[model samples]
Target: MTDWIASPLEWLQNYQLNLLFSAVVVVVYFIIRRIVLPKLEAYVERDNLNQQTFRSALFTFSLLSAVVALGILLLIWGINIRELLAVSTGIMALTGVALFATWSILSNVTAFFILLSHQSYRRGNYIRVIDVDNYIEGYISEINMFNTILITEDRETVVYPNNLLTARATIINPRDRKRPIGKIEDFRKTETSVDGGLNDKD
Candidate 1:
């Protein structure tokens, strides 16, 4: 038990320079987590970003930070990062070729980030996609990694690909201090009238 405790102390004394470098790395990681992450989270909250988008961004940032920290630790331990990166790149290239369908998925993911940055529309906002052949107007119900769901006036749900949405022109109706053109009561009344007409015919 004493040997184990003394061994670590002796190693630390012998490797003072390495220990100092490691301490610096740990301090930097904590500073980034404490200072940088909170600032990013504050910005996301200020923009009223969706939970999914915020989580994705946060996860990406954390993953990048972990990778950087691992690289620094590897260098501190005298590992050759260049050879490791080269091997990783080769493996990634092969994986990319095998998962060619991933390109489409990646495009949708990329568009999701673009949507967050653009902030043109959000869930619960009314929007109209300007398409001559396939026009769509509805309230955004959800924004996912690959699709945006909209609920129409007719109670129909439409799923639009994120990539397609990014390419199209969209008109957004923000929640300003103005009366809504159509209320939920109006839709309810219309539905009741339709049901009544069907009953009368029966």
Candidate 2:
């Protein structure tokens, strides 16, 4: 047991360097999480939580924790840089798996943010989008990071993926902000055709 300990004793003798590095890393981690993140959150968050800011903070914290852990592991195990690289590669692989698993959720969330940035529609704005074979027109009930909740003229709330709403044509009612003017041009065309037919008959 003593022999095993002494075998790498010469290379691992610098306890002071390891301790200093660890201390700095821990200090940085706390400062970012407790100080910086909260300040950022205060600015970004009004009534709704800022998912993008929160995710950014989470990623930063995760990266810092992983780096600190890796460094400490190297110092304790006396492993060289090559082993550290291998471990980091494995961590990246796991991250890739996580991203793939939650891709749809992430996509919808991202699309929601994009729509908000455009200032296209807000709650109570009437709008319509093509879904499957027909376009669903309704008033915007709530816009969140995941799905857009729409209340149709029939007084039904329908949920749609944010991506679909942002991608397709949505007609908003400029008159009555309470209800969406789903398929605006279609209604106008129909009315015009009917009026022309009546005029011809007269």
Candidate 3:
């Protein structure tokens, strides 16, 4: 029993550098989580990102950090970094192919970055998507990584793919208008004025 315990301890002592590297990785991870993450969160908050968008961005950042940390740990364990990178590249290539096979998934991810960079729309802002006889008008409730949630006038929630929004023309109304332009009453009034002017011309 003592030999079993001592054997593990000896192995650990033999790889003291690896042990120290592991400790350093742990410390760095904690620093990122505790300090870096909070700063990023604050920045997102300051920029007025919604809760869902902030959480998605944070999660993506954490995942990337974990992947980098794993690569460092592997390097410290005497693995050839070149070989590891080659393997990672192969895996990424395969993943890229898979994502390409599902075009919407890839497009949405691309559109997400585009949306992040452009502040044309935000939560609570009304937007009208111009489509062929399918004009969608709603207030943005949430903007997630893959989709933008819209709350319609009738209180119905609609999920629109990010890519679709990015690909199309969207009219954003920063302030909720008391009478939306699409209202029947407004259209009738315009039509009546046109008719009255036409009769006067006669």
Candidate 4:
């Protein structure tokens, strides 16, 4: 009976630190989601942005956080960092040469998260992007994981890169399509202009 009781106590003493750390990681994850998610929603809602996109962002963030937490737990239970890096590298190597050419695609994916947080653009919102080469005036039709689909005033469809859209100065028609010409607000700067650039009427 003493041996049985001592065995369990010894096991607990050995694993108690791991148990405490694991609990901490779980609690922190919950705290972050609880505090951060609502703030994200509030920011998106304040701008009248898409809740769907914000949810997508939240899902992505949550998934990454979960992965990190899992890694921490594994480490607490004794997984080597070098071993983890080797596994990660092996997985990357399996992707082969095509991975080398995915810089633009990866950048756009990263930019999508950044763009979704902006106040100036939304799905179905009429706006004009003042790109480096020229300007695109259109109604935002679809925003995907890679690109933003724009339907121009001339009935043309434009597949604009999320990276460029975030980088450039965009004009949003605040009154929406009904008043598509007056009071253009810049994407980078929140200032509104009435008597100036891009005379978009259609």
Query: Evaluated with TM-score, which candidate comes out highest?
Result: 4
For model 1, name the residue pairs that clash: none
Which of 2 and 4 is ahead in lDDT?
4
Q: Note each model's CA RMSD in angstroms.
A: 12.3, 7.8, 7.5, 9.2
Give the Å error, residue 165, model 3: 3.3
Task: Give the whole-model CA lDDT for all candidates, comma-separated.
Answer: 0.70, 0.63, 0.74, 0.70
Point out where model 3 deviates above 4 Å: 1-25, 39-60, 94-120, 129-135, 154-156, 166-170, 174-202
Clashes of each: 0, 1, 0, 0
Residue lDDT tens for model 2, 1-202: 9988886785467575776776776676677567755654443353243466456545654665677665665654457778777986797676556433334455555565555545456556677576443567777776665678888777887988776777676666644433333434666788999999999999
- Using TM-score as the measure, name the better of candidate 2 and candidate 4: 4
Error of 4 at 172 (Å): 4.4
lDDT of 2 at 89: 79
Error of 1 at 42 (Å): 4.1
As for model 4, its CA RMSD to the true structure in angstroms is: 9.2
Q: After superposition, how far is residue 190 of candidate 2 from its true place, in Å?
A: 14
Worst 10 residues of 1 by lDDT: 175-184
Clashing pairs for predicted structure model 3, backbone only: none
lDDT per residue as tens, model 1, 1-202: 9999999999888888877898899899988988867765654565565667677767866876787787677778767678867876886676455323334666676576566556566667788775443446788777666788878867788888887787877778734322222332555788999999999999
Worst 10 residues of 4 by lDDT: 176-185
